[model samples]
Target: MKELRSQAIVLRTMPLGEADKLVTMLTREAGKVKAVARGSRKTKSKFSALVEPLTLGSFLLHAGKTFYTFIQGELLKSYTGLQHDLERFVHAQYFCEICDRCLPEGEPAEAVFHLLLTALETLEVDPHPARVARCFELNLLEELGLKPALDACRICGKSGGPFRFDPLEGGLVCAECPRPASSFPVSAASLAVMKRLLAYGFQKLSVCLLSPQSQSEIHQVCLGLFQHIFDVRSLRSLQFLKAGKPS
Candidate 1:
């Protein structure tokens, strides 16, 4: 057995057998790793609390042929703030789902790892989970090399207002150009907000005031981009979030 130590955030966990659990985590150094926590299902298990989803910790793992085994872990931050609110919890889950989908196994994804960590931390105190989510979506797309052209027209490289977003072309199409059949009209205000969200870091979202109309527009645009780029039909966590919200 080979011993390895790293800073990790628990992504998810599944029960393996009667007393053990299969843990999936995103590490700062090693990217995504799947390890088994022996006896984690038992009441007396030391790994039980530390392996919960969204917990950040330092983990010592024993590498085996198939999967690593959780040896020792020191809890850092459990992000308990997220658990207090249903909306926050679901949003956090959506963030984790995106990461699991976008990141490749056993690859070093330092940018994504840091992005998720920062997003999680922001979610703990940020009153507007939607803003954090939007920021995360835009940044995640950029990190995965799927960033849509928001500044200039994809066809003519012209920068101006009142553009339409073409999902198939993966960019904003200028008003002068012939719009694609799938292109949806986007207002100058909405486009500007999208650009600002992409350009700025998550921390700035706290002070940013986005109009209700702009929020809806940005949500639709980001959702369309996710479907077009990642082929994600629907995210379960997002569904839970919508269902839980007051109408």
Candidate 2:
């Protein structure tokens, strides 16, 4: 049997049989992996907490015919503070879910691994969780080769703003440029904020305060881009997030 040992982050977990769990994780060395954790469903199982989603840990596993079997794990980070906050926790889940959906299994994704780890670490203490999340999403999109051109109009190549974001066309469209029926108006302020979010580091994100209008615009743009590019109709975490909002 082949053994694999690496630092990994749990993406999600599901019950298997009666006492075991099917765990999905993103590892620094192996990208996304689905493994079975024996007896993890039992309260007395030592592996129970280690398999919780959003956890970072070092793990040992043995390859089976169909799946890898987790043998041991050492908790490296639990992000306890993040789990305590509902908004932050849901955002973190959204981040993981995106990675889980986008990345292929067994292919090494070191860049994405670091991006997610850094995002989680930043989300734990960052005053502006939304900025952190936006940055993470933009960076992740770039990593996946789906980055939208935000610098100028996708068609005209002009440097000025007051552009409309067309997710179907994958970039900004100026008034002079042929706009698609799917394109929607995006304010200059919101565009500037998105450019900054994509370029700035996580430590600097706390300084960018977003107005409610700009926030909604940015959210829709990202959501549209994600859905159009990945063919993902919706994210479960996003539904939970919307439901949690004050209506």
Candidate 3:
């Protein structure tokens, strides 16, 4: 059996039998992995602290014929501190759940793993958590070839001063598309901001000048697009966030 060590984020955990856990993790090298952690559920188990949801850690695994044994987890960052504030905790959870659900169907993209780490790290201090999340979703879409139409009409290839997102077309549709009225109406400014976000790297997020209104609009657009594509109402954390403000 081969041994592997890599950085990963805990996406979820479920109890198995007793004193054991089944963990789902998104790793830098493996994309996503499911492993068994023995005795982690017990009060005195050294592994309990390491298997938390959304915990970022480096893990050592012993690959077996059918599965891997989680030998150890060395914590890198645990954002649980933010959970003290209900809203921040909700937003973070929503962010993680979206990531866990929206990833592509194949080998894990290493770049995305790093991007997620950076965004989660930013949430620890950055004030514009919403902006960071919106940007991350857009980039994830682009990487997965699920990018929405922004600047141009997905149908007529119309050069954009205006266009509406027509998810049926998988992007904006031009007037040339029959019954373009069926498309969701999108404002020109919204298109511009969306374009800029996709055009720039995520690390450049802080440098942009965005008004409060613009930020909210971007958030709506992202949620709409993501929910439609993934077919989920929203992240579970979003509801918790709606119930309280970040501290």
Clashes of each: 0, 0, 0
State every prediction's TM-score relative to the real structure: 0.92, 0.92, 0.86
Candidate 2 per-residue lDDT over residues 1-247, each given as its tens digit: 6999999999999999989999999999899999999999999998988999988999998988888999999999886568788889888998999898888899999889999999998888877677777788878887888777888888879979778999888789988988799999999998888878777746568788888788778878878878875745477987887787611
C-alpha lDDT (0 to 100) for residue 205 of candidate 1: 86
TM-score of 3: 0.86
For residues 1-247, what per-residue lDDT tens digits would candidate 3 score against the true structure? Answer: 5887998888778999978998877788877777888999998987898899879999998877655779887999897887875555666677677777777433667877876777777777767776676677677777767677676666567885455566555577655566554466667776777788899856677776666666666655666666766854656676565555332
Candidate 1 segments whose C-alpha is farther than 4 A from its true place: 245-247
Better of 2 and 3 by TM-score: 2
lDDT of 3: 0.73
Better of 1 and 3 by lDDT: 1
Which run of 10 residues does model 3 get worst, by summed lDDT?
A: 238-247
